[model samples]
Target: MRAVILPGKKEVQVVDRPKPVPGDGQVLVRMRASAICRSDMSLYYGGKPLVGGEAAKTGTIIPGHEPAGDVVEIGPGVRGLQPGDRVAVYLAIGCGHCTYCLSGYLSLCSQWKCVGFDVDGGDADYMVVPAQNCLKLPDPMSYETGALLLDNMGTQYHAQKTLGVSGNDTLAIFGLGPMGSAGVLIAKARGARVIAVDVLDSRLEMAKELGADVVINSTKEDAVEVLRELTHGEGVDKAIDSSGNPAAQNAALDSVRKMGSVALIGETSATTINPSEQMIRKLLKVYGIWIHPIWMFEEIANFVIDHNIPVDRYITHRFNIEQAAEAFRLFDERVTDKAVFVWD
Candidate 1:
């Protein structure tokens, strides 16, 4: 198998590696489509930190997490799954017995392992994952659409869940990237009034096509002021920050009304908050979401299957496994909304 191995920062090569066999309770998936996430780009560009908070250290990591594939084989003791099943892989591998896992908060677990980050990932021909992490893909969906469920789509679902969106609230997302674009559709499907915010005119137009009630270009207009006026001085009911920029976070806080919730699901190295002084003063709820629980995968899978939201809209580029470096470069340039690796 040929896998892109990152031995260090700015060092990635498509090298021959042994194919992995599934262990107990695991499944070997022949990847059909795996998208390049921002985290993967960070690791490739030497911007992502090591998992243990170690700085300036990189390892032989194969980075990719958003994956959709066919089950090629099942490990021993794995039940309820068989070869030839189409599935989406959950990125987080948590100890099922941990307190965080028991409470459906796998991201907070002490031993939480994320595929493509802490563990081996789907950047190769075949990747092994826990059978429990597999969610059945709908019959008619393409592998590319199924691929988004793992991270990008799941992030939107988590944001909605975290904010307690009741389908009646108006939602605004900052940053019209893949996650933010998908969020428009998800929020609309939940019956919320959706607004998309970005500096990109094309993305804002795409968001409008995806059912956003309004679009705001923060570059040309004051986004916080516009939304406040649109809501008649009350501000939006929910605001999501996907830009991962400190300014976006502050803008989200400012754009949401009293008692409104703000969800952060994008990549952030470090961000400073004023000890919730503003949040307390405004009676706001701010949540920083990194990973969603595995169960949300199944739920989101159903949503995608039912609504058939245009997941393909996010794909502006596609590459093979060997073109990993170019993928990272193009993604960093922001020349495209989303990029994916399609296996032969």
Candidate 2:
């Protein structure tokens, strides 16, 4: 089997390795599509991993969390699934006995291990995962769409659902990357008027194509002011910040109406904001949303299929596993929106 490994410091290696055999309650999948996520750049840049156990710090684990493929083999004790099942692999591996795990919030388990970080992932010809982590893809879903739904689309879906975004709400999204683009699509499906803000014109343009009612270049124009104006001085009904940027985060906090909701989906270690002015005094509701609960995959999939969401439109580039280096480079430089590794 051929796999990709990031040996840190912007290095990418495609190496030959023995195909892994599934252990008890596991399954072997033939890789078909694997999407690159921004978090993967932590390993690419030799920084501390955003999530995982010790194995993630080693930089030897295959680095791909958003992946989907066809099952080829099942291990002992596995049930209800078999060869030829088309599925997307969930990123979190949890201790099934924990309260969080039992409730299907695997990532919240104290003993959780992140796929592609704490363990070998799907950036290869073949990979093995616990049977419980395989989310069966809908018949109408393509491998590319299945892969993307695991992260960007899934996260946005979960966030918007939590915020109760609806026809009466105006959503201001502070970022226009893959995640924000997904936000645009999902928000539009839910009937919300979306306002997208980003520094890059290319990203803002893409946001417009994805159904944003208005796009704001925060660098050229004051995003908070524009959002306020668009909402007739009342401020937006809801806001989401996926840029992980402090300035954008502040803008998200400052641009929503009093008592409005805000979901912060970006992974940032720290940022400063005034509680009194941006949150407390306004009685704002703020949520720190991570990945979706394991059980929510069914609902997310149904929503996408039912709404005919163009999930695959989020992808801007595709590469064979052999082009790992170029893929990482372009994604790191922000030259692509969503990049994926694919197999024939």
Candidate 3:
């Protein structure tokens, strides 16, 4: 197998590697499509708590998590899934017995381990993951779109769940990145009036197509004031921060109404953010969102399949597995919203 490994800061290379055999309760999936995520860049550039730190150090890591593929082989003790099944693999393999998993918040499980981040991911010809973490793809969905259903879209769904946004609420998403764009679609689907914010005009235009009622170019306008005026002096009912930037986080806090919820879904490495003023003045419900639970992936996939969510619109670029380095470069430049590495 050929895999791209990020050995150290700003280092990535493709090399031949041995194929992995699935252990008990695991399934070996022949890679089909895997999408690069913002968090992947963080790890590649030395983010804290690197999931696959050891593998990365040894120069053998394969970084990818938003993977969709077909099961090529099943290991001992695996059941209910078999070879040839098309599946969207869940990256976070949480310990099932943990208190967090038992309470249905598996993303918060203390012993959670992730693929692409914690182990060798799907950026190669094949990858191994636990059978329990795989979600069967609908027959009609393309593998490229299916790969995103579990990870990217699922994150948006979870953020909405946290903020309790509904048909009657007005929401503002402070980023037009892929996940935030998905939130706009979901929010509109649920009948909320969505305001999307981004510095990029192209992304703001994309957000409008995805159903955002208004798009703010934050580089030119005060996003908070814009939201306040749009909401008639009361801020939006909910605001979501998906830019993973401190400024965006602050904008989200400043754009929501008193007592309104703010959900942070993007991965941020910023050590300090002074939210005390906003927290005290607004009595806000601030949630730090992580990756979503597996069950949400099923529900989100159903929504996408049933309602035909325009998830494919987020894919601005596609590359073969050999183009992994270029994919990461584009991601680094923020020139593309989402890029997928195609294998089959």
Candidate 4:
């Protein structure tokens, strides 16, 4: 088997390794597609992982959390699944008995381990995962689309569903990265008037392609002011900040209507904001959304299929596992919005 490993400091290695056998209650999957995420850059730079335990800092684990493939073998004790099952692997490996795990919020489990971080991931020809973590892909969904839905699309779907975004509301999304792009597609499917904001014109263009009603270059124009003007001074009905930039986060809080909601999907260590001015006075509904619950993949998949969302359009680059180095480099430099490793 061939696998990719990031040994820190922007180093990428594709090495040959023995194919892993599935352990009890596990399954071996033949890798088909795996998407790169911004958070992966932390490991690329040898920085502390954004999510995971001490094992993540070791950088010995294969680095891909968003992946989908076909099950080739099943381990002892596994049930209800078998060879040839096409599935997307969930990123979190939880202690099943915990309250959070039983409720399907695996990532919230105190003893959770992150795939691609705490353990070997799918950035290879083959990988093994617990059987419970496999999310069966819809028959029609492509492998690449299945991989992307695990993270970017799934996160946005969960956030917008929490916000109750609909045709009656206007949504201003900060950051036109893959997550934001997914936001645009999902918001449009829900019939919302979408306002996309980013510092880069290329991203804004992609947003427009994905059905944004308006695109704002925050660097050239004040996003909050423009959002207010577009809403006839009432402000957008809802806003989401996926940039994690302090300025954009504040703008998301400021650009919503008095009782409107905001969902912060971006990962950020710290940022300053005025609760009094942004939330207290307005009685705003603010939510901090992370990945969707493990059980939500079915709903997310149904929604995407029902709405005919162009989920694959979110990917801008694809590479064979052998091109792992250049793939990570381009993604790190922001040259690719969504990059994936694919197998024939």
Work out the TM-score per prediction. 0.92, 0.99, 0.93, 0.99
Per-residue lDDT over 87-162 for candidate 4, one digit per residue giving the tens place of the 0 to 100 score: 9999999999999999999999999998999999989999999999999999989988888888899999999999
Instruction: After the best TM-score superposition of candidate 3, give how far the Cα of residue 159 lies from its true spot, in angstroms.
Output: 0.9
Q: Please give the ranking of all candidate structures by lDDT, highest first, separated by commas.
A: 2, 4, 3, 1
**Tens digits of per-residue lDDT for model 2, 264-301:** 99989899999999999999999999999989998999
Output the worst ten-in-a-row residue range by lDDT, candidate 2: 45-54
lDDT of all predictions: 0.82, 0.94, 0.83, 0.93
Least well predicted 10-residue stretch by lDDT in candidate 1: 48-57
Task: Report the candidate with higher TM-score, 2 versus 3.
Answer: 2
Off by over 4 Å in 2: none
Clashes of each: 0, 0, 0, 0
- In model 3, state the lDDT of residue 81: 96
